[model samples]
Target: MKGLILKDLITLKSYGKSLLLIFALFLFLGLSSGSPLSGAMMVMPISIMAAYVTFSYDKLSNWDCYACTMPMKRSEIVIARYFVTIILSLLFFAASLLSYLFTAVIMQNFSEVYLLIPSYSVLFGLIMILISLILVLNYKFGPDKARIALILIFILPSIFTALITQSNVPMPVISESTIMLFCTIMPILGIAALLLSYLMAAKIYQHKEF
Candidate 1:
């Protein structure tokens, strides 16, 4: 898992500048607004781009065989990718907090909206986790045809929601006792998604001819 993680992190090297720009821009605007919602909005594209990077890394490097040959269990590699998603999700959550702090320091917000960040971050994290996992599944089924995975994971559901719901999804129906409900439930969902992804990836990896 550590090796797999290190390998993925290394992939970040090529896109570090773009990733930093995404984080900085979102962090800047989020802090300026003192709005978690805004912070979440800023986090969206970053998550999407990050997922793309995660999906594309191995095929582009032709490293699937190399990864399989390493001293690691197939499950470990999948777990590492899941870990990558969680870590990045947490990073975005932290960025949102930094945004809140920035706004507080700048005196740009009339009311503190720090609390709004977590739930929304969780929601976005869920989306990214599910999207990325499904991409892994599709890529597993067919190698060079992975481009379709991006569309299914990232675009199709969004387009369906937009087409059916007119680009707006309603807010959660739960009571806002505090951040705990939203934050707690989201991490649970994310963990579930990650575990499922790992299992599926492990199954696919073991059977994959590469």
Candidate 2:
């Protein structure tokens, strides 16, 4: 598992330049907006970016042949992909938080940023859910249709957020306490989703004839 994780991280080396450029752009946007929305926008694009890289391995490289020939079990390979996805998502997530913090500092409203954390936590949970769903859909339906499908899923969320941001209604009873409770419980759910995605990927890949 450790070896597979190391290998996956090493594979991301070539993507660093593109990722860093995106981060630099995100930092500028975050600083300009001085809002959590800037950070959220950055990660929203990156959730798909992470999925693209994680799955593109087999399609682009000779990795499928070598990984299958080795002692690593199919299940282990699936677990490793999910593990790497989680780690990268988390690192991006932390970057988003720091980006928002830097924005607040630049705006001279550092004290106002505490509220951003809860919203960021909820958004992270939702993104994880979407990522797992994307993986499963990609596994079952292939990538092209799945990519189109996820883009359509955004319409409803965009509408809901627009309405909430534009209206007088409260945010669905999600008080700070509820957010805290959710924050406490969400990581467990995220981990469960990660495990389930790994198992589903393993099941699909194990019997898939290469």
Candidate 3:
């Protein structure tokens, strides 16, 4: 698994400049525009791109076929990929957090919109859900069908934003108890989603022909 992660890190090094540029641009926009959501926006693309690019690299270099001949189990390969997603997601989450802080400093305002929730937690939760779903779809559908994953990366976020906008529910002011409940539950749900996604991917990979 460590070697597997190192391999993905090398793959990332080959194309990571573009990812950095994208995040920087978004960070600047988020800070300049005084929109807290903008930084959080970059987390999704960074994660999905990381996952898809790793898979794409494997296919392009015939790494999957090569890896099967190595000593590692198929389940290890699947879990390693899951670890890569978590690592990349955390990296981008930190980038987004810095952007949020810069926005607050530059704007001299830290409103309830920014303070109602730990923005990093929200972005992290969203990334976990997005990555889990995307990886499962990628495994089940395969790379030539990657358009499906790409479409999903965009669609799910849009739908979520739309639902929030159309629901017309004002953002609620939470009691300490409510906040505690959410803090406890959200991580559990995220973990459950990741575990389920890993199981799904492992099952798909087991049946897959090299």
Best by lDDT: 3
Would you list the clashing residue pairs of candidate 3? none
TM-score of each: 0.72, 0.79, 0.81
Q: Write the per-residue lDDT of candidate 3 for residues 1-210, one digit (tens) a residue.
A: 999988888888855566566667666877766775666467667676777777777778998888888887999999988998788777776666666666667777677364536545655666677778878887888776975768877888789989999999798788977866666577677788889999989999998997
Error of 2 at 6 (Å): 3.3
List residue ranges in candidate 2 displaced over 4 A.
Answer: 159-176
Across 45-75, the per-residue lDDT of candidate 2 in tens digits comes to: 5865677565666557767678898987888
lDDT of 2: 0.71
Tens digit per residue, CA lDDT, model 1, 1-210: 677787787777655445556556766676556563465465555655565567666777777778788787777777777777666655765675566556555655636465465657476656656655654755475444665665665677688877868757676676666656767677667666666766777787778777
Q: Name the 10 consecutive residues with the lowest summed lDDT in model 1.
A: 36-45
Q: Residue 143 of candidate 1: its Cα lDDT? A: 42
lDDT of 3 at 141: 82
Global fold similarity of model 1 (TM-score): 0.72
Output the worst ten-in-a-row residue range by lDDT, candidate 3.
112-121
Alpha carbon lDDT of each predicted model = 0.64, 0.71, 0.75
Worst 10 residues of 2 by lDDT: 32-41
Question: Could you tell me which residue pairs clash in candidate 2?
Answer: none
